[model samples]
Target: MNTATASNFGVAASAGGPLLGDAEFQFLRDFVYRHCGIALSEQKRQLVQGRLLRRLRALGLKEFASYCELLRKDPAGELGELASAISTNVTSFFREMHHYDLLVEQLLPRWLEEKKGGGRLRIWSAGCATGEEPYALAMVLAEALERTGSKVDARILATDLSPQALEHACAGMYALDRMGGISDERRRRWFLRGEGRYEGYACVHQRLRELVAIQPLNLLHDWPMRGPFDAIFCRNVVIYFDKPTKQRLFDRYAGLLEPGGYLFLGHSESMHGLSDAFDLVGRTVYRKRVS
Candidate 1:
């Protein structure tokens, strides 16, 4: 769900810096489908053209064909950058406050009570961009553990496709400006404000980092973990995917979730006609129906 921007990458390219042509565009369209599970339409051609320019410039290539060749040679390596070129990863700490509200107000307390005797409690941040979402989850989970004095073996699995994003997530640092969604009390509790040369940034507390395991994952590919997770947060990720892809993804989620596990979607995303494994319960919140 996350892609690496051009700023951090250097690619070599050749001559004739013309616009992205038909044959090359078609190759990209087909390639995106095969690798990324996205169906690029004619309507997106202009937008793709504009975005590809950034990739080409970042790669130091003048020709779109050169970029295509790069993809042909190393599709897995370049796929993330190309995806990022096309769609920016827009995420923030507590981006959708309501989702956190559900976790804080109901889910956390309930789960802690159930697992208090050192039982495992797992939650997955399916497309955790740059660590915000999972770290935020850690904050609440930490508080819940202390409040109830629970002995739960709790952890948050934060994963994304973009290597850059996962690296940033691993760093667990953020500019102070990005702390808008975090309240002053929580801020003081969970973040270490940077000073001197590191001024204007905040590093997540070591405790929070321990609760989150950051990892690289492309949802379209095979997953490495077998889980009966209690909840999964995959917000704002599948909007670009076609129906079949979405359907299969939802099915897979159903497979991994604990019976009656929760699935939270993005504000604009819906499961209507896409999945019947879960029942809509709250604002974009779904519960796996125990069969």
Candidate 2:
């Protein structure tokens, strides 16, 4: 009966389809917040409706109520698709170049030198949207290993909530246009250009695949791996989280990181006042306190 819900009903009725009633919207908002840790305001009602319309069409669903019912019935199986529909997975290779610059110039070298000779180094791309971030990471890590001739067992763990994104990440393929952020030398070094019917696409090299492990994960849920990860790249991800959710996630991240370990957030995200376990080390970067 609120203005936004009423306006939504009027719009949907004029378009001649089942509407997302107030009850259904409330249920959905609560469900997303509870399970996905994403707080959906009344304002996002229309955006959710607009994004979910494609899912409705794809699922051959005639009513938003049915979609809600489907969620109620199979929340875990469909959670990825729902999260994907609601959120934009805007990512690219080296999308934030400074983070990579820090890795290439500083972090990787330091980790390699410290962990040399049978040491294990783990870097996690926590919201690795379509393989770009992890592959970019692999490129640098591989170079560091080669440059140092180190025998460190270095690996990258790339995880995301979207099944579609995780699939793309596992495939490690991209259109040539998506290669723009990559330097020409890196393109030649790290990717194999496709041929014939596969033209205009390129796939990451095998060594990069060997360096990264792709898995589908919901960050709001339990993590399978117990890690003292050296660095975690969760860039541009927590902006959707509410304050409490951010606090819980940051605490969990602190629990999983080594002392003095690094966490890279999107340029816009800050850990200010959320957790005392870290110190702001650089632009949107936090380092776990040694204590």
Candidate 3:
């Protein structure tokens, strides 16, 4: 906690009530990092204070310390709410379009050719916030396979740490305005526009929904799926984690991917000084090395 954070919390306490003290912030920070591997910096103290204020109010707690005590008492129950508040779920359809371009133009074609004899094609959308990334991947993959006239079966496993986000993702509905990035052609092809009481919303087509399986997953914990994924979209996810956490995660991803499988990271993220299992293949993309 710095002077600025202390001042902010002091102001909030004087006016709005329930101050987040330095020790409280540290406890919450360590707790979140231990549970979810999200490293909150000192700069994020104000952010955590602001976000958790609502939780404190909801629980009718007057002090941040009391809230922390409650969290310790009911780890399983309160953790989800805390995660929902602290986690950033920003995402969009066809976000970072170049990755999709690469998938459509090069990776999918080569993968189809490699598995042509008879094998399954699988992609994982790790940290798949609100389902857009996985849905986008499903659309691109379906279109690519259709264009190439390949008959291989393909599926996407979309996972996230937040159960609330998973529920929303599973619903597969979005406001019509959120479809701005999607082309009219794709919107028509893949989403069912709402009508009557359901106006202003669009539901992902059953065809696309059928291809995705949404599940709640904390990336820090053990993953149940036995995957040798062909490609993985973990973009913009590990930016919240520290180096050692990122190293362990990248190592786990390396183990989960098939040889030569692609891993797509956020534009700002890299595997440099983290893991040697992957070699950079394109901008923010890496391919697993054969062992």
Best by TM-score: 2
66-125 per-residue lDDT for model 2 (tens digits): 999999999998899999998889988998798888888999899888887567899999
**lDDT of each structure?**
0.87, 0.90, 0.89
TM-score of 3: 0.92
lDDT of 3 by residue, 131-235 (tens): 999999999988888888998888999998777788889999999988887999999999998999889999999989888999888889889998989988899
Give the TM-score of each candidate. 0.91, 0.95, 0.92
Q: What's the candidate order when arranged by decreasing TM-score?
A: 2, 3, 1
Q: Give stretches of model 2 more than 4 Å off.
A: 1-5, 8-17
Clashes of each: 1, 0, 0
The candidate 3 region of ten consecutive residues with least summed lDDT is: 6-15
Model 3 misplacement above 4 A: 1-11
Error of 1 at 124 (Å): 0.7
How far out, in Å, is residue 195 in model 2? 1.5
- Comparison by TM-score, 1 against 3, better one: 3
Which is the winner by lDDT between candidate 1 and candidate 3? 3
